[model samples]
Target chain A: MISFDLRIDRRGFSFDVSGQFDEGVTAVFGPSGAGKTTLLNCLAGSMRPDSGSIEIDGENVYSSADGIWVRPEKRRIGTVYQDGALFPHLSVRRNIDFGWKLVPAEQRRLDPLEIVELLGLSDLLERMPSELSGGERQRVAIARALAISPRLFLLDEPLASLDVARKGSILNYLKRVHDEFKIPMVYVSHSVTEVVSIASHAMLIRDGSVLGFDRPSALLLTAALDGSSVERFENILHGVVGESTDQLTTIEIDRISISTRHQNKNPGEKVVVSLGANQIILAPSEPNQLSARNVLKGRVKEIWSSNGKVFAEVDVGPEIIVELTESALNELGISVRSDVFLIFKSSSVDVFDA
Target chain B: MSSDASIIVLSFQIALVATGVTLPVGMLIAWLLARKQFHGKFALDVFVSLPLALPPVVVGYALLWLVGTHSWFGSLGESVFGSTLAFTWIAAALAAAVVSLPLVVRSFTAALAGVDPRLEVAARGLGSGSFRTFFTITLPLAYRGVIAGALLGFVRALSEFGATIVVAGNIPGRTQTIPAAIFTRISAGDSDAAWRLTIVSILLGVMALATHNWLLKLSSTVSRDSSEVG
Candidate 1:
């Protein structure tokens, strides 16, 4: 577990945050200027907090009252910045070996080649950072950070620079890293979909203060209702691959199966599917001959209005939030406890490694 | 003819020693000025830059006081070397180094500053301390600029005249560099010797400057390409 209560005052911005994050991926979600990066910097020991205490795995790394401060190198915390920040002069292999070689043999836990293989950077080992693509550079950065066997891994918007397709692939690699290594991570991002897809716990921060901390979906809902601008809502569902064909794959979520466009995943593999709340259409009865592949029977569990839109929480095995206009809600006579069928095309669901 | 060749060799020796002495010290000062904040930073910067603004003769006079057998350093030098340092070839090299240090520091400062500080931070995060990071990452990235800075310092040291004469004197075989030799030859009405040394000095200066400019351009390109990747 990692816990910190930090306060820092800049020229015009002040940050006061305190949270205890458990083992797993805990995301610090916020807007661009919301002090998410500042908080990460404090945790990584790059920036000192004006006053506070930070404890990692029951050891006090920082405590202002005790006058104790661990340097970044001694903290054993690995950090991956948004830009990768690889040494431009070193080859990819040398970059990964940099931190690994610094660790004492008795303390080293990870094999360097394993990290290279994990990030699929074998062929690029001889190439300099400038020779690699943006995605490849980021992968090398991740591999470099992982080579240190850091007790607490901190990433600040690692996917923010990648394109959408690249982001999805990198996110999959990140999930695999977490699952394989079991390193506790504090990931900072502004994307709700990323947090929902990867983070087991989420903290919503705004203007240097944490607005909420809970499960990713719940915090996002509260944040959205609290007037925080979530660009669009996405329903993230975790499931296992039930069956696969060349045309489609069926994902079983809490005993309810939903089909998505063909994925390369094998049967029984765990995956997370993301469908935009706005893409879901609601039908009062099971419609026949619908072109959409997914038609799940559900009942509205709750209804709320925010930012001139209506959000209906429907329990279709897993609770999913569907966005609709106020007029549509009234026209369909949708309310809490009303029976409805959620419809979405299989192509609309984005499947990612869980 | 032999005298002119000896003067050229002596000038190269003095300039090479000066550049060698100033390279490490100048890089240290540049790194400090570029990467650190301290109470006396401004004062230190001013002190380092004093040689650039003060007349070379004035700088030579200050050096004369500091090593003229009357000061603590002079006493130490006397005990260590069995002689006062002001009138020796070492004094000439010292004078050249002092006059050229500011140029080296200016170039090194710009070079070190051009490197991304974030890379250093990343190294530190990866378990390398500040000193290790400087050697492993910062130095390699800024080596081109460092070479350019050293070249610039070498050229400045080669052409050093007023200060070398004041401290080391115009000893033909010991302390007379090319510039001082040119002065001595002109004084003796040996225009041919003076003109020969002048041409050699110009050629050396142009060669060093051209290399410095090329290295600087290459360093800029490297940084630009890396920035695009980053």
Candidate 2:
């Protein structure tokens, strides 16, 4: 495991983050110039932040205050850049086994032959780097880094340069490597697809600060992914697949049961339900159960404002947040501790990024 | 015919000796210029290239003062070899090397600059130090440039006229080179013999260019093949 408090100042931007990179894949996702790659460089000991501490397995690799900055070459952390950075003169075999044979015989963890086979480079071992495809070159780069048997791995947009198909294949390979290695990795990428596929934990960064860090499933339902960025109807909700009924359906988000008129996939398949939070209407005084497909009664737990709009936190057994206009809240006489019916048009929302 | 032919042969021998003597030092200096950045790097670079802009006679005179058995370097040369460098084949070689230093440096510098720094990082992480990476990765990658520079330096030394005449004194068979002998024959009105050596000069120039082009082609072809495989 690796833990670091990042405080990187470059040009006009400054990034500060405090998080734990546990063993497995932890992805840093954000827009461009968000200092994700800069963080990787810090972890690799190549780019020392303005001031912070970096520790791997509780061993401090760098701390500017204590004068404990470790040089990159001495840092025993493997870094794979976007270019792969394979040595051109060395054959694929030599490139992959480059540092493996140099380490004291006892410390070498993975066998060179095994890495070659794992990376599918056995047939191309004798060939030089100039002879490999982009995908093959990246594989060799990964194998070479693994050959060093380092305690930590830093992958900075390893598939960012490849085409879509190649990127997909390489990302899959990367996921497999992260799963098998058990070494802590700080995977830096801006692509949503790449992050969603392999990252168990996500750190949402913007403007050089850690906007949020949480498990992907939890963060998906928050206001961040609530389609605030998208005005259409976007909401991420976590719920389990309940027993199938009829054309009329039953759905459970956390503990509160909601009847969704939309049906996709079979029962027992857990999923993240995404829909327009704006579609939910608040009704406090309804004479009869109207034509609204989803009508769940829950108390208004919290009300928050953003950009002059309102989002009501509803405690439907558990808490579920809904975004709506201030006019609608006032028209329904909605306030904290007020019991209100939640109406949503089912089939307008569907499960995504399961 | 025999005298003219002998002058031509001796002139070529002197050029060959000069090229052979200057090559290794030129290569080392070129690598230093291309790969290192020390204090006064620009000053040192200018110093290495000075022989190119300076008059060939000035370079010859400077060498004469430095190694002509009277000055400090001349005295050191006398102490080391017990023979003065002036009016000697070695002096012509030294003069040609001085003049050709810039070419080798520029060519080799470009070659070294083309090597990707990422490759060096990969090698170092793989546990090889600076020297190993330079030799195994950097040097081989830029070999065409090195070869082209060497050939260019050799050609410059082979065609050296002003410096050779001043330092080596254009003696027949022992210190003479083709260009120096041709100059002497022209001065003495031996037109037919001068023309013959002129043909030899032309041939040498063509061969240097041919070799340079061949090396360039080979470099590109090899690079293409490697990239296709990689």
Q: For this target, which candidate reaches the highest lDDT against the unseen true structure?
A: 1
What CAPRI class is candidate 1? medium
TM-score of chain B of each: 0.97, 0.88
lDDT for each of the candidates? 0.90, 0.73
Q: How many backbone clashes does every candidate have?
A: 0, 12
Q: Which runs of model 2 end up more than 4 angstroms from their true locations? A: A1-22, A29-31, A42-74, A88-91, A123-133, A163-168, A200-354, B1-39, B68-72, B218-230
DockQ score for model 2, please? 0.38
**Model 1 over residues A222-292: C-alpha lDDT tens digits?**
77676555567778888999898999999999969999998878899998888888899999999999899
Cand. 1 Cα-lDDT: 0.90
DockQ of each: 0.72, 0.38
**Candidate 1 local Cα displacement, residue A294, angstroms:** 6.1
Worst 10 residues of 1 chain B by lDDT: B1-10
